[model samples]
Target: MSVLPRTPPRVARRGRAVPVGGVLLFAVGGTAATIAVVWWVAAHTGSAWSPGGDLAVYRDAAQAVRAGGSPYQVDRDGYGFVYPPFAALVLTPLAVVGPLAGYAIWTVLSTLAVPAVVWLLVDHLTPAGDHRRPTLLAVGTLAALPLSPIAGTLLLGNVNIVLLALVLVDLLRVRGPQQGILLGVAAGIKLTPLVFVVHLLLTGRIRAGVTALASFVGTVGVGALVLPADSVTFWAGVLDSSRTRPPGEEAYGGSIRGAVLHLLPEAAHGVWLPVSVLAAAAGLAVAVWASRRHEELTAILACAVTGLLVSPVTWYAHWVWSVPVLALLVARTWRRPAHRRWPAGLLWLVFALPLPWWVGYVLGWAPLTEPAWMMPVDLLYTVTAVALLVLAAVWLRRTAPAARGCPR
Candidate 1:
């Protein structure tokens, strides 16, 4: 089949047997209802958090952009607003609306993205004729909502959820050369998704990889043209938090590299460096093998998990990959004799709880003396992410040769 469709497809898309409007109504309506319900409960219970805290920084950057100034001047979590100029350019509209109104729009879109991701995964990965796509979509979105990654993204008003949706639409929905453009725009805003380009190349989608790279460069070029000073400041490494704060000191960082380094007393880039590199190499190797075996979803997921592990400073927000990752696992294992399905449930429970935050409360995050017991809890997502990668590779290796030709 051609990647580009010249006319309306004779058959409807795999995941969109239902109309898009209906899906949006369900997703957006459900998400908004959940918010209202939660707010009502919180009001009665005297417990609540103001969502869109991070949008304040976004607004600050957007204001700077509107004033023809540099966005890198703003701070986020004690670090600089650590994104490319294109990201600020994208947020410029928020400045026009002001922070409160911006949060309203961003939060609504972010909520829509949360369930849209689930819709995409269910539409693509679930076996046909299952008759449970919508149910699973709703369940998966609800399951993901309380999980730290999605929850933190929603509460903090971050870009991770939207970026997840962008990447998913690019990979699962887009059938043309345009497949890579969304992913490229995502990577332009945050560098982690750039790893998908390498995934495309290793899987023999060389054209897709090249297109993604070109799109990324085009974003940078646009940034340079529109926000020359800010783009130069960013590209010159002016806003790099890693430059001043050693990886070990980033207690909130959930990457394997950061978690391991934090446990040590001194700066150990050498120690953390080789380990994360090796982990990434192994992950990409598994991803390549899965691609060769035609386990395309597994291959795509392996790359996503690998990116979370290897990024210098992954946080709870970056683990937004967990929702689809878990959903894919459940989809592949459901009603199958070849593999057990219970492990996916176990993983869901792990991600659903605030394990690290519980540990933080115990350790009194006062300058954070992460004791031995706290290490595992603090490293919960990182270690599990690494294990999830290894386990996926192992499961792929164990599948019978006869089953190798089918894409799962």
Candidate 2:
């Protein structure tokens, strides 16, 4: 038998060099993009904002713990400590740092999360050996960082990025005993992440769901043990009231509740609760369908959007979900020609542009005291969330003939 000629060692080495080159390119690009975005944000946002505004709640609460005071009694500028008491325990270390130092550390961490999240999304959706993956990730991070929601997250020092990391890392992991603990702790810190527990259940990740529930309860128990009176007031009273809605926050909040309350007369405000419930139910069903189809990204997006829409208050800062949505849309449309890709482009433009300006313009003409902006910019977020849920529903239904029947 004739032996096939062996490839030259030089040729094999050249093949190896290409991917190493790709890796190096990725590292340099990612680092450069992250630095540029962070610097731009810092330079533009002069020191006019409240130093550690949202973070102050945690820091102040932690300082209270240090002072042997109750965290629940803590209120910074009329915004009481809304998070579970366990979060105060977690944030106690930051209390040691001065305000400016804490703000700097928090900003840096949130800034880093922007690129890290973008990288994770691109890495997940893009296939291995695609030469464009690293470049796309770096470029996408650059593009996403300046969007209004992300900008707001950084400026306000919100915990949404940390929350996003907890959910995404848990979702990306292989099924295991330790899978949902982080998510549970995240929910314990902020109640919104509990929706992911529903996601875990819908996806048939029963063990993970249980672990998450247990972890969440563990936080509550820890809080009760550490400060029983504060725990009682928070769980019993503070959690489900207008008090949890911060002062003047309705104008900035973008939830369905906010939109409905803005759109309708004062007499109709009560209608928002039922409407929110229905929207959440429908959204979760769509997430469940996405899960059944193994569309993990779609499912996560659906659940996150649902949580944002249904939450009593979702300020622009809470919309860290938009980053993943934009990245996923980019990954889907990158290979398509420009002519066939306008839908993704349109969505990206809607997000990437300063759509917040529209909100401002509309509100200026018809102050939120008047509801006319709802016809224009006021309902923009609520509408976008509904559209995404519809898209997820359509995607799941169209992909599987057996699943065409409406989900209950």
Please provide, for model 2 over 1-408, each residue's C-alpha lDDT reduced to its tens digit, 9 standing for 90 to 100: 001123366765566444546664765565456445444544444332323467767778889988998887887767777788888888888789997678778877877787778767766765545445555666677677667677666666778888898888887754579988899889988889999998888778899999999999999999899878778878887546477545554544578877776767474468878999999899999888777766677788999999989888776667778888876665555567779878766776665445444334333542343234333443677788899899878767776422332221
- Per-residue lDDT of candidate 1, residues 20-50 (tens digit): 4565566566799756643333234311222
Model 1 regions more than 4 Å off:
1-29, 37-50, 127-129, 243-249, 336-340, 355-377, 401-406
- What are the lDDT figures for the candidates, one per model? 0.74, 0.72
Clashes of each: 0, 0
Query: Model 2 — which ten-residue stretch has the worst lDDT?
Result: 399-408
Give the clashing residue pairs of candidate 2, or none: none
Model 2, position 30: C-alpha lDDT score: 55
